[model samples]
Target: MMFEENPPSSYLTRAAHSEDSQETITAISHVLRDQEDTQLVPADDSESFAAPGDLPANPTSPQQRLAKLKLLMTQQKAEYESKIARLEQRNRELQWEIRDTQWQLGQQRQRHRLAEMKIRNAERAKEDAERRNEMLQKEMEEFFETFGEINGWK
Candidate 1:
């Protein structure tokens, strides 16, 4: 009957100052006050929370409200822990991928070095063959001139 006569704001004001009024208020109000004191309010809602001493829309008893809050806290904790685990697993996978990429790059560098060495060796072999051919041609020309002079075939 007193609650019906007095407004919710007046009850909040009385509860703020009086210990007797705090007992009359719901436990949820006390919990909210405790959270505010410790700066640990749940971050589920972006909008402003209901003011302290505000009644639930359905008017549940203090015990029921407290139990509901406990259950909600448990669920949120589990969800956050699961998210952290998934993120850790993804981080490990990324590290493995980086290692594999580095290994492939090393292999490519070794192959490139071997290919350059082969090209240089082939170029050197070609030069040696050309020099040998030139020497043989000179020898054949000298033999022909000597034979022509001895046979009197100016």
Candidate 2:
């Protein structure tokens, strides 16, 4: 007997005896009847279903597309975070450099002020030494004149 498109005669006869063949035939008939009674209902026209061609044409299902987009976003976010971290590190280095530069400038200015003070002090000392030398020269010249006058009287 035929069950759906398959003939049960071949499977039933393959068994050892007539009783076994009858039992096999009965089981196959029951399965076929159950399948026929519980037929799968088709989807409505408004409802969308994934066709076999759809996945190959689109290259991604809706869930897979969302996951891919999320992955790309996460990668971009990580890159941006790394860039920001690098920039922050560079900014800190620049701040340190600026502080060092300012310290150098202050030290140079201090040295310049000290040099100017030393120059002013040297100028004052030179002026005082010149005044003392002029006074000593005048005193020596007067003593020589008095001594010459005294010697002439002899």
Candidate 2 residue lDDT tens string, 90-139 = 99999999999999999999999999999999999999999999998898
Clash number for candidate 2: 0
Off by over 4 Å in 2: 1-51, 54-57
**Root-mean-square deviation of every model:** 13.0, 22.1
Query: How many clashing pairs does model 1 include?
Result: 0
> Which has the greatest TM-score?
2
Question: What is the C-alpha local distance difference test score of candidate 1?
Answer: 0.56
Candidate 1 versus truth, CA RMSD in Å, comes to 13.0
TM-score of 1: 0.52
Clashing pairs in model 1, backbone N/Cα/C closer than 3 A? none
